[model samples]
Target: MEFYGKGNLWNFVEEERRNMHFTRSLSFSTDQNVSEPHESPFVSPKASSASATSIPLSPMSPETPWKLSPMHASPSPSLLYHCLASLHRYEGNVFSIAISRDFIFTGSESSRIHTWKRPDCTEVGHIKASSPDVRAILAHGRILFTTHGDCKIRVWDVSVTEKFRPKKITTLPHRNPFFLFPKKNSHQHKDYISCLAYNDGEKLLYTGSWDKSVKVWNIFEKRCVDSFVAHEGHINAIVINQQDGCVFTCSSDGAVKIWRRVYGESSHILTMTLKFQLSPVNTLALSSSPSSCFLYSGSSDGLINFWDKEKTSGRFNHCGFLQGHHFAVLCLATIRELILSGSEDATIRVWRREEGHCFHSCLAVMDGHHGPVRCLAASLEIEGLLVYSASLDRTFKVWRVKLLTPEKAAMEELVVTNDQQTEIEECKMSPVLSPSWVEKKIQANHFQ
Candidate 1:
């Protein structure tokens, strides 16, 4: 895409694309000779041998068949796989992750920002701003917008390189600042920004805050286009469905608000109101469809609720609730029919949407980090389905769903066998085995 304007913003996007191209070429050259293995785990000789029967067929049997039928082994486990490409370590928990065409940006509790490559997860740049805690990162074309605890939104140009790093081009601070969710009698509160999103096609940036408000800004003109008080409680997430020209926002008050920009006589009018309610909505995600729309929102009560825009009267009914993670769902991403969610329970769950009323089924449960998962992002480039998740463990992980190679399957099988043998050896050495050992000794003496 051709980025307009003549300054640092244009230069930065160009430089990032150049660097990405160079890295892509280098990776291709290095990975050309590495071929993936291709052995089928289902058709193993041991499995086939085990299927054979030891007893002869009975004459009274219907067919008098002695041999077992050729058994077709069960289909291999869906071939889903994940690999850690690079780890971005932070001082505190990472709250959100965003990716553009080239770079992956992460916001952390340390009030710092980090950028990395898409598939490789190579660190590209870093920035430390006055806002000590960053809550959201939104990237549109060439600019990266961040919302922080200082009750201000900062805009940075991500294309220009200064001292081998991208420099901040401009910063936009919030005009009216207040506590995120102020109590009835509390006056010393500042509204904390909970989420940020951008509609590049419309040149508009949106932010949701704990003050139960959603604000929109025009980046090209550098002014607030419109602002609306959206929810009764803290707004948790905001997502722009550019295809339908509808902006969706969810809040802790358990409601999802939809805003549409209506072209007025002179300027534009942001017609905003509550679209539906998915109580205690913590995360929001839109499907890839352009006409009939669907939204997936996760709640604080460990429920993933689905809402179909074309079916109900602007009301989100819980079509299906995925039950697995025990804590609050923090972030969610949808790519076609696949949905990936991260939660405070320190687990990442992948779900596939089926055709029936039961929309999604758990496909994989990734549990390695010892801390709560805070954010998730899905990448469709380089890897088919890549998931980047940030957690309270102070590390960001990259996971991709790919078919397992034969060599990997072999290695896993060997590891399983070794573990089984070790378990058997431990059982033999256990104190509880003394009685069995005496019985075995007596039987051996009698046989001899």
Candidate 2:
């Protein structure tokens, strides 16, 4: 018994020694060993596990503890983004997040649209509506537009005071019974309003609905000016290009279509259609810079497909895709060259496109939510960027991203990836139930 105990301990120690040597050898293995297609944002996969038998290890000393590394890595600018604050409410699942000049707005399953102040993310005020559920809220200058589960849209003028008080402007398709009858076509949406987009230049608000239609409302006039069937499936999201007044809509039918206003008229005409993967696209973001323009679509298959607009051709062409999330990407927001995607995997990933190139790299993965992340909003700051995210877990988070140089960011990413790989290797080497515990359990079972 004495020899058995000592020998077992010696074997364990020797096995650990061998494991350290094996891990070191594996660490030096080339990145070409990784073959998974969806392992990273970059074209080439990082040092993720290639298969069940072969595990990749990061280049690190045996004495290094895996927990010492930060959860997220710095992006292209080598900027490190970390969560600054979290806002929690048991009211209901937050469905949308929007940012204006001063306030950050979040809509939930409840009728109230919650507001938080900029920089500090302090709960400043809220807007209550007569409807029972507010599915989406959007802010343009001082104007607030809310879409309800009751299939209606409301306009409000948000007063920027110490306390936020939004004055009701008017509801679309005027509810006046004398002007419109129940049997008559009210021009209002026939089904639930799913998403909204606004064009300040055209003074139009575009609402996409589960009814598979897109409705255009004249903001100043507060009435539906045009309506059209946009897709065969429910419309999921819509975005507008301010420079050209082009509206882009994505639907559950796995298609994206672009529309342009007829010259000097309220009518619109379909300009283009983009459909690559059959996966249902949930969100869309258009990143337009002085030098480049790209449109990104997040879909149910966890792929972020982006299209680059041709300068001379004036058409968007499918360039490449960003793959990192393990589940459906529910929401997406872009600021400058950086894109933030919130997924059903309960993680928010940051990706940056090269200034003038087609290449993109996963900078970081921010995770704190216990449920699917639903909506995201981000804005550029002097120091870095500010990200506001809402999730089905009924939580809102504010993140501050600090930009670092490319060299420093690359080094930081290497360290983070190494830490993750090391942790995975460690998990593989260890078991939850030790032999000693199993032996004890077996003996107790025999006795019993």
Model number with the top lDDT? 2
Q: How many residue pairs clash in each candidate?
A: 16, 2
lDDT (tens digit, per residue) of candidate 2 on 158-198: 76765455678887766666765555456878888989998
lDDT of each: 0.60, 0.71
- Please estimate how well model 2 matches the true structure, expressed as its whole-model Cα lDDT: 0.71
Identify the runs in model 2 with alpha carbons over 4 angstroms from their true place. 1-77, 177-185, 406-448
Q: Report the number of the highest-TM-score candidate.
A: 2
Worst 10 residues of 1 by lDDT: 65-74
Error of 1 at 188 (Å): 15
